[model samples]
Target: MNKKFDILAIGAHPDDVELGCGGTLAKLISEGKTCAILDLTRGELGTRGTDQTRKEEATDAAKILGIAERENLGLKDGFLVNSEEYQLEIVRMIRKYRPEIVLANAIDDRHPDHAKAAKLVSDSCFLAGLRKIETSMDGINQEVWRPKQIFHYIQWKNIVPEFVIDISEYLDVKLKACAAYKTQFYDPDSKEPVTPIATKDFFESLTYRAQDLGRLSGVAYAEGFTSEKLVAMKNFDGIVL
Candidate 1:
């Protein structure tokens, strides 16, 4: 197997990618589509675990999900901005990975960083295609590269999804990947102070949410996503869910 990836999922913090689209990613990788993850921050501000622990957990989750690569940009936790500096950094990654499709954070979510990171990634995808942008790494100019599509994964909010991938068979895989972050999700044994996502109800809601979307789309389980531009297909038959 090659080390390069076909899809690169980006999130503002660790575990965001898994929570949002871990099943979809696992499903793709199962079919031999290479996958990678790029986390903008180490989630240092998280209530449960330290940055180092989160990084290690992310690594474990990546292995479980079979991702080709996982990287953290080390951006300041809870304080990332959409500036030229940040945009260029994202652009460089986009070019480096050269993914065919880019999965990014939701456009609107409970966390402010999600939406901001989504825009930053979306803009970088466009900027990466511009030869005049003049991006360089290690003193070598980079070639312009843009992903064919950018899909915004749904998270924390119930906005209507443009499309949904049936993840019924991969649900267990997704749950395991999410559970790798023991300090973040529901865990009765944990002594750490609980947060909204750390509650048992929140964990149950995550499953029900996928089921609800699946019910609407006539699937057993599915992950939803939104598209900034109108998505098209060869014909109606090409539509799935």
Candidate 2:
């Protein structure tokens, strides 16, 4: 599909987006803005789930978030690097989707791949705008496109947010979306070995974290984001008091 998206969220692993900005995405989609997700890896190396299970879970999460489309780059899990080849692949998706805004992985996180994917996606966003950087899809040359803004979502770390999106109405949707990754999350009866994210505490932390961000922002629930460049607002009217 050649349809343009209002925003595109890219993550190093399948559940990263869901953990990071699923609430914001659900809020945006509910407001009629189209969004898509691009997963850099299938989370093949995740402790609790296989690649096939993650893929299925991702699809299910996308539906919950009302994503227009979801794609996996099939990049190696846990081995992401900011290489030209990998950057070009990301560039192609940027050009193809032509999104005005791009949501990306946290700059630094517990997982090294998260930081690596952040740099990879950020570089690709810049390179995608250069006319000389040629890229093609489906035997057709893609047009040069660059997102106007790139916002990194909070993940793992309690990095201070540049801004927060009120997601009180969509928090339930976000939780449901996250729950799609059954194997990756807390499963009381599972035989899989426990991982960092597979504990009951991690599952409950999702709600509490959002609630904490909301408390700081004076909202019932919220999601946080950090921008590489200063954010500009048209006016003070949109600011939530």
| lDDT of each residue in 97-143, candidate 1, tens digit only | 88999999999999999999999999989998999998777777788
Q: Candidate 2: which pairs clash? A: none
TM-score of candidate 1 relative to the true fold = 0.95
Tell me the lDDT of model 2 at 220: 91
lDDT of 2 by residue, 92-114 (tens): 99998999999999998999999
How many backbone clashes are present in model 1? Answer: 0
Worst 10 residues of 2 by lDDT: 1-10
RMSD of each: 2.0, 0.8
Query: Best candidate per lDDT, number?
Result: 2
Q: Give per-residue lDDT, candidate 1, residue 161.
A: 96
Candidate 1: worst-modelled 10 consecutive residues by lDDT: 1-10
